[model samples]
Structure formats: structure tokens, C-alpha cells
Target: MCSLCGVLGGRGHWTDTSSHPEAFTHVEQPTRRRERQERTRLVNTVLDHYGLSLSDWAGSSYVLKTKTGQTALVENLTELWANAEQLTKHDFDPLDEALIDSLAAKAAR
Candidate 1:
């Protein structure tokens, strides 16, 4: 629905009651938004050319650049199982999708 009619039709990519069935919340953190766009582009480029998901190397983590142009990694530092949450579906390789699924699982616990 989303890939075809929703997003393609400019109806909505997040909400349409076809899947979510709820009013979606839109949070526009500029930093996060820019990072997300960059990550998405990186993932698509990598996947298209390399046929590999970044998660394979990242162990399902994301990296960030700080205001001072420094680098930081936001990860589950709890020392839990590398995949304890059973997050991320088997075939969902796109960075944004996998991250969302992974985060959802972590939050549920």
C-alpha cells in the first residue's frame, strides 16, 4: 500500500490507516532528519553496489557526528546480547526500516 499508492500518490508514507491505523506522530529533529537522509542514501548506494547491508558490519548500530564535527555512536551499551531484542526482521536491510524495527523491539522490552 505504502510503496505503491500511499507514498507514490503523495497520500502519506507513515499513515493511511491501511497499516498503522493510527495518527502518526511527525517529529522533525533537524539533526536526526539530516542523519536519517544521509544514512538512507548511504544504505541504498551500498546495497545497490555491494548487495550488503551495513548492519552486517555495524552489528545493528548507528554512528553520528557531533556539533564539534566529532564522532559518536549511539548503541545499546547495556551489554545485553548483541541481538538480544531479536530486533530487525530477516530480510529488512534498508537502514531506516531495520533501525525502526530494532528500536521498537528494544523499547518493548
Candidate 2:
């Protein structure tokens, strides 16, 4: 039994509560592998519209090459997805308008 939650040895015992005073005791952090998978999924979905794909560049970085042979350095999948969302809202070339609209609409959902 624990003092804070009155539960047995489970989730609460894993975190160092002293470091995150404001964080809830039961709040769970996403694992690195899970985050990577999610990022890959989002990046793939966004890039697939343009017939592009994400390839690992260096550790923790990715490269998205467009059909026109232009390359975009995605520091991380989150950043890549965000840039796509922002650019699609405007008139971004190289990306088909229909695809942009479709991806943007999907993101909204």
C-alpha cells in the first residue's frame, strides 16, 4: 500500500514525483517507442497524399523527398506534421490542391 493513492505497487511507484510536483501521480507518459510509431504514422499519412515518404536520415531525424526531387528536412515527425498542416492552409506548390485539402480536412477530424 502507498501513502498518496492508497494503491499497491503499480503505476505510482514508477515515477519520481519529486521532479514533477504539478503533474498528477497517475499521469502516464508515452513510451519512446510508442511516440516514434505515432510520429511515423502521422508523417506517412500526410506525405502519402503527395506520393512522398519518410526515411530515417540520422538518429532522431527524417527526410521527406517530394516527387520533384526536392527534399524537406523533418527534424521530427511532429514538426513535419505541423508544417504540413500550416502549409496546406496556404497555397503550397508541389503539393496537389486536392491532396492538401483532403489532408487538412482529415487533420481537422
Q: What is the lDDT of residue 42 in candidate 1?
A: 52
User: Mind giving the per-residue lDDT tens digits that candidate 2 earns over 1-109?
Assistant: 3323445544322232433446745467665455556666776776776566777665345666666565666554344554454434433344678877888889898
**Where does candidate 1 clash, by residue pair?**
none
How far out, in Å, is residue 101 in model 1? 32
Write down the lDDT of every candidate, Cα atoms only: 0.36, 0.57
Top-scoring candidate (lDDT): 2
Q: Write the per-residue lDDT of candidate 1 for residues 35-98, one digit (tens) a residue.
A: 4456545544433332323222243344433223433333322211122222221243336666
- In model 2, what are the clashing residue pairs, if there are any? none
Q: How does candidate 2 fare on TM-score?
A: 0.43
Off by over 4 Å in 1: 1-30, 50-109
Deviation from native of the Cα of residue 44 in model 1, angstroms: 1.1
